[model samples]
Target chain A: MIKEFIRKRSIHVCLVCTGGCNGCDIEVAALLSQRYDLEQYGIYYHNNPRESDALLVTGTVAKQWQEKLVEFYNKVPEPKAVVAIGACALSGGIFQQESDKVGAPVSDVIPVDAEVPGCPPRPAEIAIAVLKYVPPTLASYRRKI
Target chain B: MSSVIWYLYEFARKTWIDRFLNAKTDPEIAEAPSRFRDFPEVQKDLCISCGACVFSCPSQGAIKLVRDEERENIFPVINKSSCIRCGFCVEVCPTEPKTLKTGENYLIMEEYRILPQEKVYIADEYLCIRCKKCLEACKIGAINFKDNVISIDQSKCVSCGDCINACPVKGAIKETYIINIDEQKEIINTLIKSLEGTINLEVERIRKLPDHDPDKIIKLEYPLADYLQKARNIIPNDEMIIKTVEKVTDRLKMNIITWDDEKCNQCRLCVNECPTGAIKYDEKIGKVERDPEKCLRCTICYQTCPFGVPGLYVARFLLKNNVILITLKPSQIPIRG
Candidate 1:
């Protein structure tokens, strides 16, 4: 009953930046502002991966971030879902030219459930992606458990 | 004490308290700005199937051409997953009023004002005869020799029709209009029907003649001379209309000329008169030889031969239950050369 109550009332998300321009981070941050105020939807933005229910991943996975991303993804709880944001996260944007040195897509390092693919997606799109995709993934995870 | 009372009264107001209690933003997603270009919308009927949208799209597999559900019309379909809403497809659209649109200020810049053109010029390789007349006629050097074949550079060519005018052979350089495709088909149908009608009228008279032989040699006037003006109203290009008429005449096999080897008197009249040298007298066999490959079917030999060595026949087409039936008969009177 307590688990169901926690699932229905609140979801905690962790923002992880692999290696890209911080354009998508600003849009994700706008969700907390008065214009969007995503907290009203019973969602909280927290950096701690241990307690978070979802991971909002931004930027292309740099060479150094590849091993660190696996460690970060493993730290998150079992019911966690990953949402890749921006063109950099889905496919290495302009950074793909130096592919050997830096650019690698987030999906290459860790599994992704949903993707919001703009240069830097609008704040509403990020909110929609979190709301629409994360719940079902958590539900499916509970069913498997 | 008055200032304290005013502050207390302002805090106690129900309207001011209600404003803070309500949600700060609208529950729905905010409306994007007028100039914000999202995914482009396609207007299918206006699309010319020129593949301009497909060519301009930077994202591979974002846009591609596909036939409609009815399989009659072909248009572009956008794949939303791969599309970045870049608006390149909307900008490069060549049709007037655009076949692809995104927003009010979708054009973005004035320098990219794409001029809409109704006519497009193309080169016909089969009828080109390897002549480089178009290359010289093009002032902008739009026509060039590519891989041993002359091809037109579409970007450089301005559709001035100078290359078409310079071409010696008919149907070598073609000017194709993009609009009114259905009307063009209807006009071609009308022209074919009118040509069949004119030849059918003459065929009926020949059937009643006392000396009428189905294989007799005769002549008739140009069949499409009367209906050329009527067709010009719908299709303004006279040369294009004439080319269509010629192509249809050939496809239907409406005109035929037969050479009778036995009827040749060896007078060498046709050999001298033949402009194309299709006929020649052989000294070894003491007989005249006619080459069908070299024959232009110009009917010069038909007029030159007094013994009716060459026979000219007109064919009429009858479409019955989806099957075309062609009937060939000789002209009733000899056409004056």
Candidate 2:
């Protein structure tokens, strides 16, 4: 019941790419498209960080893009959650071996609320991580539904 | 107009009213299979009559090659009967935006189809050039042209698309699906036996290593021996010896240089600068050989090497002490880092 209620409250999320191959970003967009129908649960990806309640950061934070990452993280409003999605964002993945730039794990740079681990995590896994921030009443409602 | 109104009324009554009333008992709802997000679906329009999916499909005979006589092209005809629906066809398809579409509601049992071990193709004795192109293309070391003929163990091919992409000459490497179960099983059994022997060798090597002490030197080679000897000679004090070892070992922890023979200029800069003298240049082979035992694992060599380009091609460290050493072959290197 709580799960169903949580599904009703619209969740505006911002998606950002660090220095990754864009595989995870592409998959994340695919989830929001007609195939995954993420809209049914009122979870929507927003283009602006100001309007978003949470941020989904993908890829390894490359040295060249570290400043950009920090800026993006700081721009999001307070009580805003960050979900590091993919092995690269969490542990620098394949890129860690290629470059001297040790990618700052999301937690190292910013407070990360949750992590979705995979070369590119399955879209379903991303959805579950987002649910963690939802209010308890809404969460229970989503469960009932 | 009256007929149109009547049709609309009936459609609404049946769909809205009837569906709501019968929601619990409706066969469509009751029998409908659960769906999960990201489940793949085939897009017929984008499917280029390429039979690559059919040949690569791991679900034994689940996808069949069918000739569309009218279109004069071959296409994959997926047999629902044997389709464990693991989406191998979807994942491996070379098409952009993917011909397969997976929906959120679609839930298919996630089954990883253990593909019948692929038979490694052995180049004919008369045709092989001993160029070692196939050897470099093979990720599993299954292809060896040491005897002037490409010999394949017919076991290690995972169909990971490495050899196919690496083969410079067309027709040098080809993959074909085996339809007969008995033939596949016979080849698989033989390969397993060979793999078992290799595994035993690896286990023996691993057993000889010291217990999991981080400071204990697991492997050592000439350059490392030279460095240790030099360090001892330079610093006679026991505390200085301990400090030097600690410093060298610490530097070794950060090494990350990987080389591709195709891109390498064969410069010995990395070999010379290596503090531990871990890198040895094989001038005859026109490649740098890394002595893993001697390597301090410091990534300075990687940073210094001009040929070290980042991408899927470079060798990466799998663990703190273990490094995947990629050497040049006539073709592309086989190591997947």
Candidate 3:
């Protein structure tokens, strides 16, 4: 039916790196390579948020990125999803105890859809997250658990 | 010539045809359970709070043993997120059964393992205001400025504490454990209630003028450490703060700097131990006496007393059980702030 038609069409994903170490970005790159070949699964990766159906955010959000995170989060069309891609994004991770945390946990500034906790998750993890977590999140932004 | 033709067919089959064909499911995800490494897990009951893991942590606040607001209890809280999974905490825990049990195969490389007594420098980059002033003091080129952040390269840092000496902010750089103020939430909140009331009233009276800058953010000392930090943060004596804060919730219970005459034996050792000369022998009275006003209430008299006769305990603060014992004696010392 209509769901099958939507499944075949690509999910436009925007990658937003706030201030992370960029290891997760490398994993995201691997997902698009020939081994994983994310395009085959009806997915498209880009930097622009306005065209995106999903937003994948990685890194510890600094004060400078706080406003930008909200701006980008708002730009995505209705029924959009946000994937917090690393430890810093989920709970400020290693930076949790930092005093004067201006950028802080991403959830503080914008609504988060899903959290993937790892220093840097493997490419398989990211691919699995796209298959498992993203669409359900897009269906409804409420946390699955 | 036949072999060359055969290899060309194999290479074409590998790329053009197979590029379109691949496994439907990811293999690594299936193998994740076997390949992943879970960080070390702590056994709460087994831990002795002996400062073993605290000594083993590479940096401060990584493994802290602190008490709750009640001060009647103590526990070990590990920040596994900051832990490098080095297994040093597992190795050093002295209990017959280890306290920090290594979750997976914790293979410690010699370089990753910090010795029990070794020191490491730590700084929270968020606290670092990129005022490149730390650069001018360092000659070794260990301090690097990049990405709007000034940082210490652990590999190049000499642990000389020069950066700490030069920094205008006390905790901007540290040679030992970075004393994060967030850990003392109870004391900070208590201070806020006490200090805020006075400061707000004073600010309201002064801020009615047009000269007051609206954009200037007046930072509150929310953390007790923020109140105490000087030009350089030499690790403060935590035990002293913990003891004093616990004993003197109300000033009425504070140690009167008195000693037990029954146990005094007039060793006069406590007299020597008094840094402020609070304890002394009166030749005319032919007995050891204490000048309460001069007493610093450091508990050294109780700690050093050979009799172990609950001598300094009475001087420092009345114990819950001994409050009745203290009420019997008439003390003329009026409370002083």
Candidate 4:
């Protein structure tokens, strides 16, 4: 019961940046900054996937990094959430044509929970995406009754 | 008679000169009548060499790239008869500046041309270190390293998850979605609920505040401040509540107090904290009450309430493990004194 109580109070998120340009990464990091203040919603970032309830992945899948991508996904605990942010993650975008190396599309690689598309999505959008994964309330049904 | 003879001689001389020059040309060209033919001209400077046009061309032997003697890149040369006028090469070029133009007898044909599929890089299984570096590389979050094996979750995946490109191992991760349906739904639903709760809280708080008046305390801001003061009395050491109050007040651009209700132990924190002496205990009702207008929603009374209920309508309260998540719904429920 105590474990459940602790879980309801805080949301842990893991952020990962893949092989695309750093545009999406900057936007996502802004959420944790004072301007966006994601912690107000009880959302906190975690370095370890084991402690994370949600995972935010940014960037396109490059030919060289495919293996690391899979390992990260497996490390996240069950009932975890994953969000894909950007056009590169959605489609190969410009890189799809430029490189001779064949890079995998995001959906073709892991189980994405949600997709937010843009060359680089705004910071507000990233915060909104993170907020979506937290539970609505911590009070129980019996308490209401 | 002399002028007429001169003119005749001059005309015959010119005709003889033309016949002599024509006799040197090929026999086929000499026998056939000349006709205008339309042909495509490629802009070598604009081509980025993406190969979209080259790969898209349908005519087997129609177009070939020959090195430009004066330029660094290759240029396309067309054998007129070999070109079926299909125009596939013009449609698929990625560089718009390098388009093929046909002049005069040639009409410009614009059509959608599909390029041939390029092979996607799939990770080979043997080299995987399970580091998940590629997973972080992907913005789409499609890489799933499950059970020491890397695979894709096809349904939620877009195939652009290309974390495989960053993998240290050659084929540890492949391009494919491997996760099942139930798991995906759980992730999606949780995300939705979390987002809704946060948005609703923000909206509700803003709506309760007086519309952008700039000067006076908005209805929502004042009441929330009061509620925080009340909560602080009950949980004196609760840093979370204090931080929340500070954060909210700053966001709303108002002065506020952080109430700690954890230490109250049933002792009325409000009776002491109220500035206007508005709080009064109702032993019969087993709860305290205050005059609505006189109370100021200052939340001084919340600190003494013993229970963590704020001075507002409770929308939903969920208890999971030991944590409490509360959703407060704004309402005009009167606080009877």
In the order shown, the chain A TM-scores of the predictions are 0.91, 0.80, 0.86, 0.80
Please give, as one word, the docking class of candidate 1: incorrect
TM-score of chain A of 3: 0.86
Per-model C-alpha RMSD: 23.6, 22.3, 18.9, 34.6
Query: In model 3, where do residues sit more than 4 Å from their true spots?
Result: A1-10, A39-42, A94-101, A141-145, B1-26, B33-36, B51-88, B91-97, B101-337
Model 2 spans with C-alpha error above 4 angstroms: A1-8, A98-100, A132-145, B1-337
Q: On DockQ, who's better, 3 or 4?
A: 3
lDDT-wise, the better of 3 and 4 is 3
Candidate 4, residue B261: CA error in Å? Answer: 83
Fnat per predicted structure, each in turn? 0.12, 0.00, 0.10, 0.00
Which digits, one per residue and each the tens of the lDDT, describe model 2 over residues B1-337?
A: 9999999999999889997776442233223234432334566656664445654554343555444546644345665423434566766676786676544323222423344743334345554445676678776786665545565555455666576566665445544443444533443333333323333344334333332233432232212333334444543444433333332333222222233455557777676555555677776877777775554333446546665521111111111222222211111212222
The 10-residue segment of model 2 chain B with minimum total lDDT is B310-319
- Across B1-337, the per-residue lDDT of candidate 1 in tens digits comes to 9999988888777667777677454645666667777788998898876667875766545676655646456577886655668888888898998999897663244332134666677787788887798888889997988876777777676778899999998777777766677767877778666655655566545444333365653344443555677888886877666655655554564545566677678989787656445688999999888997666555557756888767666665543332334566664434333
lDDT of 3 at A141: 44
Residue-level lDDT for B181 in candidate 3: 36
Clashing pairs in 1: none
Task: Give each prediction's DockQ, rounded to 2 decimals.
Answer: 0.07, 0.03, 0.08, 0.01
Per-residue error for B41 in candidate 4, Å, reads: 36
Q: Pick the winner on TM-score between candidates 1 and 4.
A: 1
Lowest lDDT block of 10, candidate 1 chain B: B106-115
- Predicted structure with the largest lDDT when compared to the true one: 1
